[model samples]
Target: MDQTNDTAETLTPQTVRHSILWRVIFYFATASIALSIVVSAALVVWNYEQQTEAFRERLEDIRVGYSESLGSSLWFYDEIQIQSQVKGIMNLEAISYVRVTDNLNINIEVGTRPHHSDIETLPIEFNGKPIGVLEIAFDRDAVIAKASRAAISTMIAQLVSLLLLASMLGVVVHTLINRRISEMAAQVNDRLSSNQYSPLAISTGKDKDEIDLLIQAFNALSEQMIDQLEQKTQAQQQLKTINLELEDRVKERTHNLQKTVDELNQTLAELHATQGKLIEAEKLSSLGGMVAGIAHEINTPLGLCITIHSYINDNYQVMKRAFDGGGMRKQDFVDFMGMMDESLGILDKNLQRAAHLIKSFKQVSEDQTGEHIRRFSLHDYLHEIMETLSPKFKQTQHKVEIDCSENLWMETFAGSISQVVTNLVMNSLVHAFEHTKEGLIRIQAAEEKGNIVIRYTDNGCGLSAEAKHKIFEPFYTTKRGQGGTGLGMHLVYNIVHQRLKGEIQVEEADQGAAFRMVIPKITEESNVQ
Candidate 1:
């Protein structure tokens, strides 16, 4: 019998113990009951306080009414009116007693005075002067009785409503939440006790409650765990096989990477060399254009000189032949001399102009190519630059003006400075005054606060907002298809900011674009490559 009892106890499935649903239901019931009780008590207390406040407000109204009436009665010295006012205050439910006294030693009392300590005194005033004193006492018993009745009624109603709410809630919880949770817990326990990896067999209805969602999640987790275990076993077998070739694969990849790095280094070096050559080629191309312009400019003066010389030679020959033939009179001789003198003067002027042009061209060309630091007068240097660039503007109506201080000098990279100024002037001619017939470029330089400020302004079509923003960026041009290289302003920026250690900015202009460059004047020793 003892063995049979033990077997039966074991077969009971350990009582399938899971009381979380009951415990949760009980917890909710306890919380609901506690909340209801607290709310009921609070309502009762609030209602009581509100009733007491209403009683006090009633007493205040009676006191004020009596005071006003007594003030008029006492001022008129009417005893009957004063007594009538006191009796009216005593008629108030909360007013237990009313007393009135005056400066004339008159005293009046009404109603049964209360033993409560709550009392208020008011002085009747007539034209800002106290005429009498009115004392009013409130009946605490009546106020308490009314407040208690309201509180008791509220408590009873709250209790009944709370009881009905708790009962409904308990029924809903037990039927909808607790029972479903208990069934889920029993299925989970059975699965756990049997060490079964299969999903929960609990079926769900169309409503799909929380318990159904929990079962779905548990089933998905079970499937995922089974898949992971199989994957782990396969991964272990694959890992052993991969370890055999990992070292060799690593060596092969490292070798390939090293080869790729070597090729990259070679390509990088080639690119660097190519960049240097390109920059040099660009410089040479600029110089070639400058030389062609100078040559064209020099041809005009040289040709003029040759023409004058030929005319003077012909005039001399004719005068000589006339004299040799003995047909030269004094008048002829004087006219011939005068003509000779005029021809000589013209010849000299053309030759001198040609010489000056050649000199200016030489100086500018040397300064652009020398790459040397030199102390030079800024005013004279600017004039030389303008003169060298004169041929470019000679055909056009555009004019170049320089306004540099006479004493302003700098010991800096003249070659870079020459290139910068060349770029600026050329940029203006190409972009700034593209459609304009008449334009003006003003270049001004001054020394201020130990820095040279050079302002360049052009009275051509002012830069658009977009053009101004991207003007100094390389290879960015509005006239790209028109053979614009777009490197002019970029080179200028580099020379001014990088080579000369300067800063440049574009200033706002009304009808043109203005650029201001600030470069520090340093000694030759301080100038570095």
Candidate 2:
């Protein structure tokens, strides 16, 4: 018997002891009862008030009628008619008493007199003259009793109807929702207890209720879990197979990776050498351009000088022939002397100008190529550099101005300084004023606290924010593919910072680009390289 009991307990589906349908019914019944009580009490109070008001009005009407009847009877001295009206008023169910009185000493009364609290009085008149007063009392208890009965009957009806509604609702809820939910809960418990992953058998037909939907979702989730488990098992097998081949693949991959690394190292070395060659080529190209410009400038003056010298030589020959033939008159001699003086003056001035230009160019070119460290006047050196670059701007409206203290001198890398200044000026010509015809470049230098500060500014299109950020970065150029190797500014940056031991920075300008360079007048002992 004990074994049978245990088996039964095991097979029985676990369910909640309390029924949801009963709980819902109980709550609904409680609310209905509460509402009924409230409505019943309200109705009782309201009926009581209404009945009391009606009774008061009826009592008032009785008093008015009695006053009129008694007024006429007193005027005619008809005692019997007055008595009849008083008796009729007293006969009403809510009327407790009635009285008639007047100033002429006439008086009448009927029934037992009610207390003053229940009595009300009305004045009577006859032909615009005072005749009598009529008073009546109402039975308050009787009126309240009628209202209470009506309220009680309404309450009973509401309670009965509510009970029936609650019963019907409980039956429907249990049949349609509660029983199905209980069955679903039992099935879910059974699956959980037995660790079963089988899909639940639930109807998902045209009338798809919430319970049916929940069951369908649970079943789908079970199927998905089963599929995932199968996939996991298959993946484990595949992982084992992959592990078996991993060693061979690793060996092959390592060999390929080493080969790739070697190739990358070789490519990197080649790239470094190529970059060096490119930089050198850029420098040569710049020097070639300078040489071309200088030649062109020199040719102009040289050609003019040649023509003037030839003209003077031909005049001298003509004068020599005239003198030899004794045909030189005083006026002709004076004219010839004046022409000779003018020619000599022109020749001397042209030769001096050409010589000065060549000297400046030679000095600047030598300084740039020699990399000599020498004590030089900053102002004079800057002038020479500008002279060398003048040919580039001779055809344009751009002007270059240099301002430096005359006594300020520095023993430093003259070549690097030349390179730095040349790159900056060239950058302005190529990039800063690419669109503008007329521009002004100003270079101001001064010695400050044993350091030289050079401020360079140009009244041209200024560098854009992006350009300013990357202007000194190697191989970054806005004029790519147009003879811009992008090394000019980079070289400037390197020469100034690395070679000259100076720092250069871009600064805000009113109308164009500005740069500030601070270089030590005397190099540090350890940083001489």
On lDDT, the candidate that comes out on top is 2
Q: TM-scores of all models?
A: 0.53, 0.56
Query: What's the lDDT for all of these models?
Result: 0.78, 0.82
| Per-residue lDDT over 436-472 for candidate 1, one digit per residue giving the tens place of the 0 to 100 score | 9999999999998888889999988888988889888
List clashing residue pairs in candidate 1. Answer: none
Once model 1 is optimally superposed onto the true structure by TM-score, how far is the C-alpha of residue 77 displaced, in angstroms? 60
CA shift at 226, candidate 1, in angstroms?
17
Model 1: runs farther than 4 Å from truth?
Answer: 1-257, 462-470
Q: Which portions of model 2 show Cα errors greater than 4 Å?
A: 1-19, 45-68, 72-91, 94-123, 126-130, 135-149, 164-168, 199-262, 269-381, 387-399, 403-417, 426-486, 493-529
lDDT of 2 at 162: 93
Q: Per-residue lDDT of 208-269 in model 2, one digit per residue for the tens?
A: 88878888888989999989989999999999999879988999999999999999999999
